[model samples]
Each structure stands twice: as structure tokens, then as C-alpha cells.
Target: MGINLQKGQRISLKKEAPKLEQLMCGLGWDVAKKKGGFLSGLFTTDFDLDASVLCLNQDGKIKSNSEIVFFGNLRHYSDAINHMGDNLTGAGDGDDEQILVKLPLIPQNIHKLVFVVNIYNALERSQDFSQVENAFVRLVNLSNNQEIARYTLSGNGYQGKTGMIMAEIARVGDDWEMMAKGEGFQVKSLGDVMKLYS
Candidate 1:
């Protein structure tokens, strides 16, 4: 069936929706100085960082140690899908990982796609000390390379913590939409992030 989408319309999906064919997820952050810096860039600087999209999966179930693709810059990007090792760090400008998941075809069972931020290292600190910002995910139609839906994590709830987020992307009528939800935890490792699914 053909998918229908309206221009500039925001869509949200439920958790139990089918998986999408081509998924395009991006991670971004805002790097601003928290305090004053030196004229020569030698002073202490703070960044208002936030990870927008953390968790995203197609209709198929994401297994352990999957290769997820991380594209875009600290702010945004157009080309390149950087491959990252599972449980690794994509820190710094233009640092990201693209995860490739292999799953069995489950027909309509793979209806929803979930996006999350793996906060496995920022639980003990306070929100102000936490540096996760501007994270988000988007569904792309592989057939046309068109972005169908997207979601973002904002506000104080996303200030600081080490955990994963849950965003559902499902088919609405013919097109798709994104539903974002925050799930906090004292994540110590990637195993913890995987535990959410288990």
C-alpha cells in the first residue's frame, strides 16, 4: 500500500506498532559556554548539551551488539553514516554510531520503532552536571529516501542522567509518526540499556 503524509504535520505513534523499512536516526547537542571563557579559548567553558534521539528500531527486534548508524554533526549533518561499536562513545563534534540491526520478519508485529539515549554514565551527577542535549530520531522511507516522521527530547526532564529513552514510530493511516517517552535509570553499561527490552 502507498503511504500518505501531509506537509509539516507532526505524527506520534504507539509502542506496539509495526517496524519501518528504512530508519534514519540522528543525534545532536547544543554546545554553549556555561560560564565566561578566555579570549584565546583557554578558559573553562560549559556546554548546554542534550541528546535528542537515543532509541530507534525498525519493525525487527534489535539484538545485542547490533551496528546502529549515527549520522549528522553535533548540530546537524547531511551525508555519512558513521559505524560505531556497541557500547562505545560517539562523543565530540561529528562523533556518532550507526547501528545495524538484524531481525526476523514479523509482518505487522514489527509495527513500532523505539528511540532511546543510552545514559549509562550520568546517573550519580545532578541535572546541571549532566550533559545530554538535542537528541532525536526520524523515520525515512528507504524507497524514496524521504523522512516520514521524527521525535525530540527536551525540557528539564532531559537535563542529566544516564539511561535510555523510548520513542515509538508507527504507521498512521498510510504514513508514520513518532511518539517520545522518557525512561530514566542508573545505567552502568550497555547491558543495562538492553535490559529495558528484556
Candidate 2:
């Protein structure tokens, strides 16, 4: 078992799972289905939410665009990190999107991995996290399939924000630490996020 992390809480991955090497960061959410009369079905539809990862160095910065892993680019150049794939509708019960990282294989220069979620073309669609219910990001120890830490995201605070900064895994020497961010931003695409991290 692992800790259920609250907003702003952080945990040492190494302390919880000393033998941890490979990690799986899973993100899940539900597309709100508005209830109405017979016409309700017309308005209820799946909204596309994208999960992305920004790889940063020891100083929390990316050296190149190749450090970003997203639907368009699923894997990092070094093959240390990978995005399992994109989940557009958030229809699954478990993880909608997954990013796997070979912690031990990560180069010494890379020190931080930032996980983010954004609505696909939210600016044009006028959609935000407000319509996303039961959003969550969790880190698991792939070796034993035990969750290391989980952060549940609420939509209340994301009123006008189209994107969210889910969590971060920081490299501390040979160990790793997880932090719950849950911060919302105005960006609409992964490219916008790279501008901030790169």
C-alpha cells in the first residue's frame, strides 16, 4: 500500500519503495455527462483530454523539445521515458493515460518529470477542467503493481483554466520524490507547456 496524497503534499518514493526502479504514472478522469430531457443525449459527449510529460534537468529545465513526451511524440529520445498512448475520451474506469519511466535508465542530467493534462483545443471549444470529474494522477511501482502515491484532482478550482500541472517526480541523487501540484494554467496544448518548462 501507498499514501493517498493531498494537494501540495509530497512523499519520498525511495523511502516508500526502496527497491523501486521502473515507475508508471497513470492519469484518469471522467467526461461529465449532463442530464436533461430527451435531448440530453445530444449534448452529452466525450471531451478529449490529453496527458503530457515534460522532462527537466537538475535545474528543472528542458534542454530541447525532444524532452517532451506526448501523444504526438510518445517517447523520449534517450528511451528513458515513454507515453503509453493518448486516451481521448476518458472512457476507461482505471487509468486513461499512462507514462512509464525507467528511473534507473534516466540520464544523470535529467532530474525532474512534470506531468500535465490539457483539453484538446480547449480554447476553441471553450472547454476546461470544470467538465472533467474525478480527475486523478497516480504513481505506481511497476515491479509489484503497488501504488506509491495518488493525487485526486478536483474541478472546482479549475474554473477558467484549460490545463493542469498534475504532479512532479524529482530526482534526489539516487532516490526519487513525488509532489502533488494540481495547479491549473491557461495553456491549451502540450506545445504551450513546453514553452514554460523548456
Candidate 3:
């Protein structure tokens, strides 16, 4: 298992877990089965949440569009980061979506990577984090399949938010540190949120 990180906490994967060179970051969430007040019957909600990665250069600015990996772009050109795929319904026990990264292979120009989760057509569907439960983001050592760290992104702080900036992997010198950023934003979807970093 892994330690659940608190917001703003930083974990140096390279220094703390030297064996963990490559890792798979998994993002998971669940939509509550809505219960009608009068009928009291349960209804399943289809939420198309996308997990995206934004690679920023040394100056913290997105250098190129290819630096991003998401549903549209499953992998980066350098093959440093690969997004498994999109989980349309958010219906899974462990990781609804996964992004694999070879820490050592990330180019020197890329200084930081931001993991973002945004709802598809959020405003039109009237969807937000308030309806999500057990939302979490975790990192697992791909070589050993052992969890390194996990962070919960649900609760009062996430309610009514359309997007969540789960965590950031920052490169400092020769070390990579994972910073928990369980912060929310009001963007309609991933495209809008990408502007903040781009």
C-alpha cells in the first residue's frame, strides 16, 4: 500500500524510494447512484471524466501541444509518458484511468508534469465533483506493482468544482518530487483548464 498524501505535501520519490524509477499514476472516482426522492429508485450516471497530463518546461510554461497527453493524445512523442486510455463511465474498482511514466526518461526540458481530471461537457451535464465520492489519485511502482502514494480528492473542498488538479511531479536537479495539489477549478472541461498552464 501507499501513504495517502495530504494537500500540499511533497514526496520525493527518487530520494524516498530509490528503486522506484518508473511509475504508473492511477486516477479513480465514483459517481453516486442517484436516488429519486419520491420513487427512491437508484439510477446510474454516466460521467466521462478525462485524466490529462500537461508537461511544462523549465520556465513552467507549456512548450508545445505535443507535451500534453489525454484521451485525444494517448502518449507523448518522446514516449516518456503514456496515458492508458479514457474511462468513460468512471466505473472501476481501482484505477479508472492510468498514466505510466518513466521518470528517468522525461526530457530535461520538461521540468514539471500536472495531472488534471475534468468532466466532459461539465456545464451541460450539470456535473461537478460534488456528485463524486471516493475520488483518489495514486502512484504505483510499475516494476514492482507496489503503491508509493495515494491522495484523496473528495469532500467539501471539491464540491461544485468541475476540475481537479490532483498532483504535480516536479524535477529539481536530478530528483523528482510529487506534490499533492488537491485543488479544484471551475472550468467546463479539460481544454479550458489547459489554458491555465499553456
Off by over 4 Å in 3: 35-44
Worst 10 residues of 2 by lDDT: 39-48
Write candidate 3's Cα lDDT for 76-111 as tens digits.
998999999889998869899999999878888999
User: Which of candidates 1 and 2 is the stronger one according to TM-score?
Assistant: 2
RMSD of candidates 1 onward, in order: 8.8, 1.4, 1.6
* Pairs that collide, model 2: none
Candidate 1 stretches with Cα past 4 Å from truth are: 1-20, 30-32, 37-95, 99-113, 123-130, 170-177
Q: lDDT at 54 for candidate 1?
A: 24
Question: For candidate 3, what's the RMSD?
Answer: 1.6
Scored by lDDT, model 2 comes in at: 0.87
Give the candidates in order of lDDT, highest first.
Answer: 3, 2, 1
Local distance difference test values of all predictions, in order: 0.41, 0.87, 0.87
Runs off by more than 4 Å, candidate 2: none
Backbone clashes for every candidate come to: 39, 0, 0
